[model samples]
Target: MSRLYLGIDGGQSSTKALIAKESGRIIGHGRAGPCNHVRTCQGRAKFFEAVSGSVNAACNQAGIDASTVTFAAVCLGFSGGPEDKEAHSRELIRSTKYKITHDAEIALSGATAGQPGIITIAGTGSMVFGRNAAKKTARAGGWGYVFGDEGGAFDLTRRALRAALQFEEGWGRPTVLRAVLLESTGARDANDLLHRFYTP
Candidate 1:
């Protein structure tokens, strides 16, 4: 039997899995929905779905039975911090070794090819991470959608909505953003759009 390895990138938008051989030849790839939340029952369900869906898909593509195969190593990089997710992952994957970490670390490793440098990721959220020659590392600004995540997609959308609300309420200068947002979202006004955002 050949030794197999697995790598998964679990992000806010989606999750991807790759299965490779000991020789670094990629044998399979799969993709599924997001798995960034695990604080609630519904969130944990979604997390399980995303991780299992992607891993099973990859195993199938590689012509391997996931239940019977123990990977030599597995690495999963998640969009949110990995503190709450390690145990959940352990229950699902059988691996000799595991490297569970935040998405930014993997992104920096890939971007710099394991060199000492910095990388900024701006997707659903925003964060910056770096490593120095001394092997020290530092990170900033991955506080998520509620508190931080400045310059992220959610932040930009919030700013646009706030502007539209101000315009509709006659408290701020008029701009075409109000009309554009309303047309794009099919909202009668900024207030309606805001309500829709809160509705699931």
Candidate 2:
């Protein structure tokens, strides 16, 4: 039997799984919903669903029995740091060697092909990670959606909403952003949209 490897990227927006052979040929791929948070009960459930669903789907595509197959090696990169997720991943995956790491590290590795370099990721969240030729590493941003994430999608949306809110209160100049936001979100007004966002 050929040795199989698994690579997973669990991000704020989605989870993706890829199955490859020892010769570095990709055989299967799968995607599922987000698995960034695992603190709350709902978050844990979402994590489990996303990881298992994507891995299983990939296994099926690779013509392997998910429950019985043991990967030679498995690496999982998660958006919200990997410290809190390693144990949960171990429960769901069967592998001889496992690497659970931050999503930024994997992004950097992929972008530079394992060479010493820097990478900036701006998905639902934003972060910059770099590895020096001396093997030192550094990172910035990725402070979640509230305090940081300056160039992220969520941050941009928050700024747009704030502008609309200000316009609605008559404290700011009139702009087409207000109308566009309301139309896109199907909100009656900026205040209504804010309420909806806070509700869910």
Error of 1 at 5 (Å): 0.9
Candidate 1: where are CA atoms >4 Å away?
Answer: none
lDDT of 2: 0.90
Kindly list the per-residue Cα lDDT of model 2 for residues 1-200, writing each as its tens digit. Answer: 89999999999999999999999999889899998679854988999999999999999899989999999999999987885798899899999999999899988898888889989999999999999998899999987887789989999998888887888889987878889988988989767888888885
> What does candidate 1 score in Cα RMSD to the true structure?
1.4
Q: Which regions of candidate 2 are displaced past 4 Å?
A: none
For candidate 1, write residues 103-192 as lDDT tens digits. Answer: 989888888888999999888889999999887999999988988889988899888888877888889788788899889989986678
Best by TM-score: 2
Relative to the true structure, candidate 2 reaches a TM of 0.95
In terms of lDDT, the best-performing candidate is: 2
